[model samples]
Target chain A: MDALTPHLPVLLVLTPLFGGLLAALMPRRGPAPWIWSALVTGFEVLLGLSMVKLVRQSPQETITYFIGWWPAEYGIAYEIDALNAYVILVVALLAFVSTIYAKSSVEDEIPKDRHNFFYSIWLLAISGMVGICATADTFNIYVLLEISSLTVYTLIAMGKYRDRRALTASLKYLILGSIGATFILLGIGYLLMLTGTLNMADMHEQLMLMKAEGDLAGNRTILVGFTFITVGLGLKMAMWPLHLWLPNAYTFAPSAVSALVASTATKVGVYMAFRFIFTLFGSVYDSSATLALMAFCGTLGIIVSSIRAAQATNVKKILAYSSVGQLGYIVVGFSMANESGVAASVIHILNHAVTKGAMFMACGAVVLRMGNADLKSFYGLGRRMPATMAAFTIGGLGLIGMPLTSGFISKFYLISGALHDGKWWLAMVVLAGSLISIIYVWRVLEVIYFKKPEKRAPVEEAPFTMLIAMWILASASVILGVDAELTGRLAEFAARVLIGGAT
Target chain B: MEGLGLFNYWIAVAIMMVGFYGVIAKRNLVKQAISLGLFQTGVFLFYITMSVYRAPDGTPGRAPVWEAILDGFTKDPGPYDNPLPHVLMLTAIVVGVSTLSVALAIIMNIKRLYGTVEADEISEIEEAIEHREEMMSR
Candidate 1:
C-alpha cells in the first residue's frame, strides 16, 4: 500500500483504460469481456477506497500529484481533495456494481457480436469520468470529457439493434454535446488568455490576485468566460432548460448504458460545476446573482420535470424525467451557496446515484423479463417480480424523500440550508417538489401492485446477478439513510474543504 | 490600427457564428455535422491567433524555438509566440475530428433506419410510429 499510494489517482484512471483496449482484443464471444470489465472495475473500487484513505490521512485533506514529477507551472496535476475523492469513490462503486448488472442485461438486450465493443466502450467511458474527477488541468478536462462523450455516443448508438430511435438520439446528443464542449474550450481559452495558466489552482490564484488588484469586476473577458463555462457545464449536467437531448438519449439507450450514464455522467457534470464555480472562480468573483439564477432554474426544473415524469407512460422514460427533477434538487442545494447547501448537494450526488442506479437496474431487469417497460406492461408486476418491485419500491420511496431513505437526508439539509439563508419560500419549494415527486412514484407503484393484468403469463424474478447488484445499491441507499453519520460527516468535511478553498 | 490588427478574431467569430447558424437551421444531418466541423475550426483559428505574441514595440514575435542555449546567451533572443495554445489546439483538432466522425456515423445509421436524413421528415415518421404504438397499446 505504501508503494502504491503515490500512484493511486493515475491507476484509478489507467486500469480501466488499458483494460478496455485489451478487452476489445479478446475473442469475440463468451463471458470473457464481462469478466474483464468486472475485474477492472473491481480493482478500481479498491483504488478508489485507497484514494479516499490516502486523502483522509493527509493533514490538509488534499493530495496533489504532478504527473511525471513536473512542476506545477507546466505539467498537469491530479489533485484529490476530500470532495472529489468522495465523488470518485461513488463513481467507482457504481461502475463496479453496474458492470456486474450489465452481464445478463447486455446479453439479453444487445447482440452477441457487439458485446466486446460494448464492454470496451463502457470501460473507456468510466475512465473518462474518473479522469475528469481526478485531473486539475482545465484543458485536460475538455479532452477527458470528449473521450467519455464520444464513447457514450457510440454506446447509445449501439442500441439501434433494439430501437432505431437510439441512432437519432445519439446524433442529437452528439451535436448538442459537441456544442457544449466547444463552449467550454472557448471559455478555457479566454481564461487562459487572461491568467496564462491551465492549472486550476494556479488559475484560481491568478484570479484572486487580479481581484486583489481590483481588476476583476466589470472585466468583460472574465465575465464572458464565466458565462460560457456555466452554460457549458449546465448543458452537460442537464440543468433544466438545456436538457432537451437527455430524455430521448436516456429513453432509447440500452438498459445497462442508461444505468451507467444515469448514475455517473450528470453527477460528474455537477462535480465539474463545483470545481469551476467554487474552487476555480472562488469568492474572488461575486456569484450571488448566478447562484440565484441557478436556484430559480433548479426549482423550475423540479416542478416541471416531476409533472412530466408523472405523465410518461414508459417506466424508463418516467425514471429519466425523475432524474432531471432529482438533478434540480442537487443544483438547488449548491446554489444556496452555504456550507449546508453545498454539503447537501454533495450528499445528494451519492444518494441519487445509489437510488437511481438501483431503480434503473431494476427497470432493466423488468425489460429483460418482459419485452417492454411501459406502464401497461407493469400491471401486477409486484406479485410476478416480487423482489424486483420491492427493490424498485424502496428506490421510489428514496426519491420521494420518505424517512429512513437517503433522499430524506439530503432534502432535509437542503431545506435547512435554505432556512439558514433565510429563504423560507425556497424551503417550501423543496417540500413542494417532494410532494410532486410522490405523484410520479405512486403512479409507478400503483401500476406495479394494484392494476391487474388481463392475461396471465408465467414470470420469474430477475436473474440472481442483477438482483444482487440492485439490492446492493438499494440497501446502500437505505443504510446511508438509516446511518447518515459516515456520509454526513464526510460530506460536511468536503463542503468545508470546498468553501475554504473558495474564500 | 488596433482594430485592423485584431481582424483575425473578427473573422474567427464570424465563421463560428455561421457554423452555429448552420447547425441550427440546416435540416440535413450531414450538413449539420459538417457545420460542427466548421465551428470547431473557427475555435482552432481563434486559439492560433491568440498564440501570436506582439512585443511592446509592436514587432511580431518569432516562433517558439530553442535558440538562446545554442548562442550561449550572446544575443538577446526576440520575444517568441506563446506555444501552449498551439499545442492545446492540436489536441482540440484531433478531438474535433473524432467528434465529426462519430456524428457522421450516427447520421449514416439514421439514414439507413429512416430512409431520409432530413430532420423534419424523420420526426414525422417517428410521430407516426408513436401514434401507431399508442393505438395498439389502447
Candidate 2:
C-alpha cells in the first residue's frame, strides 16, 4: 500500500483502459463485460479515495508523474493538483456507479449482441475522460479528448436500436468535435513555434520573459494562440453559440450514455478551460476580455437554455437544456475571476455532475419501463416507482438550487462573487435562471406525483443495480450539500494553486 | 523571402480556405468529406513549409544528399528540411485518413436510412416525417 501510494493517478486512468481492451477480447458470454467493468471501476474508486486522502494529508503538494519514468520537463506528465484530484474523485465515483447501473439499464436499452461492445466502449470513454483530467500536457489532452469523443460517437450510435436519430446526432457531433480539435492543434502549433517548447511551465516562463523584453513576435503569436485555443475549448465545453450539437445529441442518445456524458464529459471540458485560462495563460494574458466574453455568452446561455427547458416536452431534452443552463452558471462563476468565483465553479462541477447523473439515471429507469421519455410517460411515476421518483425529486430540487442541496452552495458563492464584482444585475440574472429552473423542475414533479396514472399496467421498480446507482448519486447530492468542507477546501486550494500559491 | 520560398504557405492557405468553403457551402456529404481532406492537406503543407531552414551563404539550398556512403556523413545544415514537421505531418495524415473513413461510414449509414446523401433533401424529409407523426398523434 505504501509503495503504491505515489502511482494512484496513473492507475486510475490505466485500470479502465486495460479493462476496456480486455473486455473487448472477452467472448460474448453471460455478464463478463459487466463484471470486468465493475471490477475496474471499483478499483478506480478505491484509487480515487486513496488519492483524496493523500491530498488531504499534503494539501499544498502536487503529485506529478511522468509516463515511462521520463522526467516531467520532457515527457508527458500527469499533474494531480488539488482541483483535479477533486475532479478525479467525482469522475471515478460516477464511473463506478454508472457501470453498476449500466449492467441493468443497458440490458434494457441495448441489444443482447451489443452489450459486450457497449460495456467495452463505455469503459474506454471513462478512461479517456479520466486521462483528460489527469494529464498536464496540452497535446496529450487533445489525444485523450479524441479517444473519449470517438467512443462517445460509438456509444451514441449504439442508440440506433432505440432511435435512428442517434446516428445523425453522432455524425453532427463528430464533425463539430473534429473542427474544434483541429483549431486546438493549430493553436498548440502556434504556441510551440513561438516558444520552442510544449511544456506548460516552460512555455509560461518563456512567454513572461519575452513579454518583459517587449518581444512583439512572442506577444502577437501568444495572443493568436490564446484566441484559437479559447474558441476551440469553448465549443467543447458547450459555451453558447458553439453548443449546436448538444441538444439533439443528448436527446437522442441512450439513457446510460446521456447520463454518463451529461455528468462527466462536458465537466472535463470545463476543467480544461479552467486549467488553460487560470494556470497556463493566467499570468501572461490579459483575461479581462476573455472573461467578458465568457460572462456575456454564459448569461445568454442561461437565458436561452432556461427558456428552452421550460418549453421542452421530452424529459431528456428538458434535462439536456437544463444542463446547458447549469453549464452557464459554472462559466459565470469562472468568469467572475475571483477566489469565491473559481471555487463556486469547481464546486458546481461536482454538484452538477451528481445532480445531473442521478436525474438522467432516473430518466433511464422511466424510459426502460415506459419506452418513451416524453413527459406524459412520467404521469403517476411517484406512486408507481416510488424510489426512482423520489431520487428524481431530490435531483430536481438540487437543480433548482434549493437549500440543503449541493446546488445551493455553488449558487451562494457564484452570486456572492457577482455582487463582489458589483455585477448586481448579473446576480439578479442568476437568480432569475434559478427561478426558471424551479418552474421546470416543478413541472416534472407535478406530473410525477399529482397526475393520475394513464395506464394501470404494473411497472416494476427500476432494477436493483440501477436503483443503487441512482440512490448513491442522489444521496451524495444531499450529503455534499450539508458537508461542504471537502469540496470547499479543495476548490480554494485549486484556485490558489492556479494563481501559484498554497493558500 | 526565406529558403523554400514564401509561395508554398500562400498556396497551402488558399487550398485550406477553399476546402473550408466547400465544407460550409456544399450540400452533399461526400463533397464535404472531400473538402475536409483538402483542408487537412493544406494544413500539412503549412507545417512542411514552416520547417525549412535558412540556406547557408545566404543562398537558397535543398535537402542534403549522402555522398560516398559515409563521407564524414556531414552536410551543411543549410535549408535542410526539418524532419520533425515531416514526421508530424505523416502522423496527421494517417489521423486524417482515419477520420475520413469514419465520416464515410456515417455517410453510408445516412444513405441507407434516408436513401439520399444530399443534406438539404434529407433534412426536408426528416422534417416532413416529424410533422406527419405529430399530426397522427394529434
Candidate 3:
C-alpha cells in the first residue's frame, strides 16, 4: 500500500477510464458489462479510501503528484487535500452503489443492446468527476468538466427508451452546459493571460503578488473574469435563477443515472466553485459582495425550490427540486466564508450526498416496482416495500434535518455558522428552509406509510441488489449522524485549510 | 490606435455575443447548437489571441516549432509565441467538436421522436404529454 501511494491520484482517474473503455468493448449482451463496471467502481471505493488515508497521514496534509514528473508550473498536477479527498470518496462510494443499483434498473428501463454502453458512460462519468476533484490545474478541470458533462448528457439521453422527454432534457442541458463551459474557458484564458500559469496554486501566488504590488485594485479585467467564472459555475452547479436545466434533467434521466449524477455531479460543481472562490481567489480577491449576492440567492433558492418540491406530484421531480434546495444550503454556508460556515458547507456536501443518494435509490426501487414514480404510486409503499420505504424515510428525516440523521448535523453547523457570522436572519432562513422541506417529505411519507391504494396490487420489494445499495447509503447517513466525529474532523480540517489559505 | 491594437478582443466579444443572443433568442434546436459552436469558437479565438507573443523590439514571434532541421535547434529562439494556449485550445477544439456531435445526435433523436427541432414546438408537445400523464395519474 505504501509502495502504491505515489500513483493513487492518477490511478483514481485512469482505472475508471480504462474500465469504461473495456466495458464498452464487452459484447453487446450479457451480465459482463454490469459485473465489470461494478468491479471497477468497487475497486474505486478502495482507491478513494486509500487516498483519504494518504492525505490524512501525510505530514503536510496534502499529496501533490505532478503528472509526467514535470514541475507544477509547466505540467498538470493532482493535488489531494483534506477537502477533495472527502469529496472523491463520496463520489466513488456513490458511484459504486449506483452501479449496483443500476444493474436491475438499467435492465428494466434500457433495452438490452445498450447495457454495455450504459455502463461505459456510467463509469466514464465517474472518471470525469473524480478527475475534477483530483486535478490542480484549472484547464484540466475544464477538460474533465466537459468529459463528465458529456457523459452525463449521454446517460440522461439514454432514458429516451422509456420516455422521449429525456432527449429534450438532455439537449437542454447540453446547450446550457456547453455555454457554461465556454464561459469557464474564457475565464481561464483571462487568468492565464494575467498570471501566465494554469496551475491553481501558482495562479493564487501570482494573484497575491499582484495584489501586493497594488495591481489588482479596481481591476476590471480580473473582475470580468471572476464574473464569468461565477456565472458559469452557477449555471453548472444549478445555483438559483440559473437552475432551469436541473429539474427536467434530473426528472427525465434514468433512475440510476439520476441517483448517480444528483449525488455527485452537482457536488463536484460546488467543489469547483469552492476551489475557485476560496482557494484560487480567496485572499487576493474582494468577493464579499459576490458572496453576499450568493447568500441572497441561496436563501431564495432554498425557499422557492422547497415550495416547488412540495408542489410537484412526481416523486423524481420532488427529489430533484429538493436537491436544488439542499445545494442552496451549501451555497449559503460557503458564502459566509467563515470557518464554521465553510465547515458546515463541507459537511453538508457529504451529508446531502449520502442522504440524497439513498433517497434517489429508493425512488429508483419504487420506479422499478411500480413503473412510475408519481406520489400516488407511493401509497402504502411502506407496507409493500417496507425496507425500501424505511430507507427512504430515514433519508427523508435527513432531508428535514431531524436529529440522528446526517442532515441535522450539517444544519447544526450551518445555523451555528450563521449565528457565528452574526447573520441571525440567515439562521432563520436555514430553519425556514428545513421547515418547508418537511412539507414535501411529509407529503411523500404520509402517502407511503398511511394512504391506501384504491386498487391494491401486490408489490414485492426491490431486488436484493438494489436494496443492498440503497441501505448502504441510508445506513451511511445514519452512521455519519451518530458518529459525526470522523467526517466532522475532516470537514473542520478542510474548512481550516480553505480559510487558512485565504490569508 | 488603442482600439486597433485590441481589435482581436472586440471581434471575439462581438462574435461571442452574437452567438449568445442566438442561443437565447433562437427557437430552433439546431440553430442553438450552431450558435453554441459559434460561442465556443469566439472563446477559442480569445485563447488564440492570448498566445500571440511580441519581443521588446516589437518583432512578431515565430511559431514554437523546434528548428532542429535548420541548425539542430536555435540557441536563441527569440520571441517564440506562447505554445501553451495553442495546445490548450487544440484540446478545447476537440472537446468542442465532441460536444457539437453529441448535441447534433441528441437533436437528431429529438427530431425522430417529436418530429420537430423547434424548441417551442417540442416543449408544447412535451407539455401536452405531461398534461396527459398528470391526468392519467388522477
Candidate 4:
C-alpha cells in the first residue's frame, strides 16, 4: 500500500484516458461503450476518493507524483491537495452519473453508429478535466485543456442529427476556444521564459524570491503574462460578456452532452480561475484592482444572466443562462479575498456542480420525452412526468436558493461573506440575484405544474437509468444542504491552502 | 544594422493582426481557418524570435546542440541560446495543426449539410430553422 500510494495521481488521470482509448477500440458489436465508460468512471471515482482520503490523512496534505521517476524540480508533477482533491471528486462523480444517464439518452439524440465514438469522446473529455484538476505543471494544464476542448467540439457537433445549429455552435466554440487556448499558451510561454520553470510551485518560489529583491512587482512581462492568462481563461469560463457562445453551445448540443459540459467544463474553468488567481499569481496580483474587477464582473454577470434566463423561451437556454448567473455568485465570493469569501467560492464550486448537474440532467430527460425543450412544451410536465419534474423542481428551487438546498447554503455563505467584508451592497446583490433566479425558476415551475398538458402522447417517466442519474445529483443537493459540514471543512482547507497558508 | 532589432517583432505583429482580421472579417469558413493558421504561425514566429541569442562579442550564436554546449563550457560558457522555447513551440505547432484540421473538418460537415461555407448564409438558414422549430413547438 505504501509503495502504491504515490502512483495515485497518475492513476487518477490515466484511468479514464486509457479507458477511453480502450472503449473506442472495443468491437462495435460488443457491449455498448457507455458500459465501458461507466465502469471506467466508477473506477476513477474510487481513485479520486482514495486520493482525497490520502491527502487529508497525510501529514503534508498533498500527494506529489512525478512522472517517469523524474524529480519535482524539473519534470512534470501532479500535486493533489485539498483544493483540487475536492474538485477531482466532483468531476469523477458527475462523469459517472452522466455516463449512466447517457446510456439511453445518447441513443436517440445522436446517430446510432456514433454511440461508441461519442462515449469515447465523453470519456476523453472527463479525463481531460480530471487531468486539469490533478496536475501541478502549468504546461500539463494547457495540454489537458486542449484535449478536453477538442473532444468537446466533436461531442457538440455530434448533435447535428437533432439540430444543424450544432454545427455552427461547434464551429463558433472551436474558433473562440482555440483563440482562448492560444492566449493561454502565450501566457505560459511568457512565464516559462521569465522564470525558466514550468512547475507552478517552483515558479511561485522564484517569484517570491524576486519580490524580496524588489525585482518583481510592476514587471511588465509578468503583468502581460497574467493578463493573457486571465483573458484566455475568462473567455473559457464565459465570464459575463464573454459568455455569448455558451447559450447556443448548450442549447443545441445533445442533452447528455449539455449536462456533462455544463456541469464540469465551465466548472473546471472556474477551478482554473481560482487556481490562477489564488495559487499562482494570487499574491503578486492580489491588488484592490483585481478584486474590484472580479466583484464588478460577478455583479454584472448575475444580473445579466438572470434577466436573460427569465426571458429565454427554451428550457435548455433558461438553464444555461441560470448557469452563467450561478457562476457569477461564485466569482463574487472568491473575489472578496477573505477566508469566508474563499470558503464560499469553494463551497459553491461543488454545490453548484451538484445542483446544475441535476437541473440539466432533468432538462435532458424532458427533451428526450417531448422532442422539444421550449417552455411552451413544458406545460403540465409536472403531471406528465411526475418523477422527472419533481427532480427538476427540487433542482429549480435549489437554483432559487430555497432553504435546505445546496444553492441556499452556498448563497448564504456568499452573502454573509460580502456583508462581513463591509460590502453590504454586494450582499444585497446576492439577494437580488437569487430573487431574479426565483423569477426564472418560477417560470419553469408554473409552466410545469399549472398549465395543462399540451402533448397527447402516452405518459411515461424517463428510463430508470436516466432518472437514477438525475436523482443521485438531486438528492446530493439535499444532502449537501442538510449536512454541509464535510463540504465546509473541505472547502475551508482548500481555501487556506490557496490563501498561502498550510501549504 | 541593429540586427533586425524591432523589425522581427513588427512583422509578427502584422501577421497576427492579419489573421485576426481574416478570422473576424472574412465570411468564408476555409478562409477563417487559414487565417487562424496564420495567427498560429505568427505566434510560432514570436516564439522562435524570442529564443534568438547573441554571444558576448555581439555576434549571433550557433545552433544549441551538444556540440555548442561543449564549446561554450570549454570557453567561457558563451551565449548558447536557450533551447526550451524551440522545444515548446514544436509541441504548440502540432496542437495548432490538429486544431486547424478539426476546424476544417467541421467546416466541411457544415458545407455538406447546408451546401454553403459562408457564415452569413449558414446563420440565415439556421435562423430560419430555429424560427420554424419554435413555431412548431408552440
Error of 1 at A100 (Å): 0.1
lDDT of 1 by residue, B49-117 (tens): 988898999888976567677677688878989989999998999999999999988998888889999
Q: Docking quality tier of candidate 3?
A: high
Worst 10 residues of 4 chain A by lDDT: A282-291
lDDT of 4 by residue, A40-146 (tens): 99999988888888877863567788999798766799988888888999999999999999977798787767767778888999999999999988888988999
| Full-model lDDT, candidate 1 | 0.92
Q: How accurate is candidate 4 locally (lDDT)?
A: 0.86
Model 3: per-residue Cα lDDT at residue A216: 97
Residue-level error in angstroms, candidate 4, position A320 = 0.8
Interface root mean square deviation for model 1, in Å? 0.8
Ranking by TM-score: 3, 1, 4, 2
Q: Report the lDDT tens digits of candidate 2 across residue range B24-121.
A: 89999899888877877887887777777665676554554433234565654445555555666776787678667777887888888878989898
lDDT of 2 by residue, A1-503 (tens): 88988788788789899999888887675688899889999999899889888877888787888889887656778888788888988998998888888877788878877777888899999999999989887777877887888788778877777877777887778777777776776777777777766667677777778768778444677888899899989888888878888988898899989999999989999999988887878767788898898999999999889889998778898999999999999999899888888889989999999999999999999999999888888999998899999999999999999999999999998999898989998899899999999888988999999999888998989999999999999999999899888578778778777766211
Q: Write the per-residue lDDT of candidate 1 for residues A1-503, one digit (tens) a residue.
A: 79988888888889999989988997778999999999999999999998988888873756888899897779989999898899999999999999999999899888888778889999999999999999999999999999999999998898888889999989999999999999999999999989999999999999989989988868999988889899999989999988888988998899999999999999999999999999988887778899899999999999999999988888899999999999999999999878999999999999999999999999999899988788888889999999999999999999999999999999999999999999998898889989999999999899899999756978889999999999999999999999989799999988888888564
Most lDDT-accurate candidate: 3
lDDT of 3 by residue, A20-85 (tens): 999999988889999999999999999999988878787356788999999999999999998889
Task: Output the lDDT of residue A55, model 1.
Answer: 82
Which sequence of candidate numbers ranks them by DockQ, best first?
3, 1, 4, 2
TM-score of each: 0.98, 0.94, 0.99, 0.96
Q: lDDT (CA) for every model shown? A: 0.92, 0.84, 0.93, 0.86
In candidate 4, the residue pairs with backbone N, CA or C atoms under 3 Å apart (3 or more residues apart, or in different chains) clash, namely none
> Cα deviation of A228 in candidate 1 (Å)?
0.4
